[model samples]
Target: LEFLQKPWHNGRLLRSKGYFWLASRHLEIGLLAQSGKQFQWDYVGRWWNFIEPSQWPRDEYRLQGIMAKWDSVVGDCRQELVFIGQGLDTRVLQRELDHCLLSAQEIAAGPLAWQALPAATAFDTEALSARPTPPMAVQPT
Candidate 1:
């Protein structure tokens, strides 16, 4: 919402989807699926970085790839998304999205503190509603 404040006048954003790390959920990976105005954030899984290395892939090459993406502070956690559109102002989009990210202070406060905030995330609500609930069985008289 913050990233796309104004609708595109010259071009349209066709699609955007990817896995990203949220400062609020430091260990979990979030999948952002977007098509036009409708977009959803779903929990993908926990970041490999947070798990024990013994549970990691046995392949050395795969391990190397993961390590390569690792950051000194956040490890492999990062914001990775793809945007496809025509005549897009990428610079402006990037800047706006960056602004939506948590500040240094917020990030430093850590996930525990983030969880303490009331209604701090919309993902949980949206995800729950998106699920298909099963109908209750009725007893025959």
Candidate 2:
């Protein structure tokens, strides 16, 4: 809701019968509620750089080698997001995000502690897909 309050905010938040998706850019930060019960935040900072098709390894073994070589971090679990907008307040945004990150103590607390966070409500996916679509009216000649 804080994001909607922004003066330059011009985007839509769509909620289907059983689906939720965000299609926005320019610092819109689209949020999606998975199955209306849980929010999937898996792709926070992980991304792949452009690699030429010709340069790509031909085999699985070679592919793994290339991935390891190019990726400084052994595992590809890092945050890397791009923000594009006019009159953007980068510092404020970064500071807010930094504050939300897990502290050293929190990280050490383990997954059990993290699971205690709030949960989302579940919705009926079948009902959403089975909903009827309106037919177009025929024009008279």
Candidate 3:
């Protein structure tokens, strides 16, 4: 809907640079909270870099104001915002929107790790075999 209201850039409406930057910050924080995976995927380090030590309270205000409250979980909406900030293309934009939306919902509900994705044993042989792997080392031909 936000995209529809304005020219589509990257699932974003192409606002000013500052707006996009702010949106990126918001989006990043939201993604971190939702996926239980921070941008750097740190154990103890800060996941959302935008919220500085002094900015924590400000974040709380923005979170409430921007996300529409715990019911909305604004923190989970950062990926789309960042994608827009970085200016992804149109199809990319829609795809991003779809993905970020799901991430947001997952975050809103609970942590992503707690939710089960199928384990290797849960799939058929081929499906299990599809697991990503490091490429075989090739020497001289």
- Candidate 3 regions with alpha-carbon error over 4 angstroms: 1-72, 75-77, 80-89, 103-109, 112-141
Give the local distance difference test score of model 3: 0.31
Off by over 4 Å in 1: 1-10, 35-40, 116-119, 128-141
lDDT of each: 0.67, 0.33, 0.31
| Candidate 1 lDDT by residue in tens digits, 56-126 | 77798877778877888776778888989988898877886787787778778888887654334554455
Predicted structure 2: lDDT: 0.33
Error of 2 at 73 (Å): 7.6
Q: In lDDT terms, how accurate is model 1?
A: 0.67
**How far out, in Å, is residue 135 in model 2?**
34
User: Model 1, residue 94: displacement in angstroms?
Assistant: 1.6
> Best-fitting candidate, measured by lDDT?
1
Quote each prediction's TM-score: 0.74, 0.38, 0.24
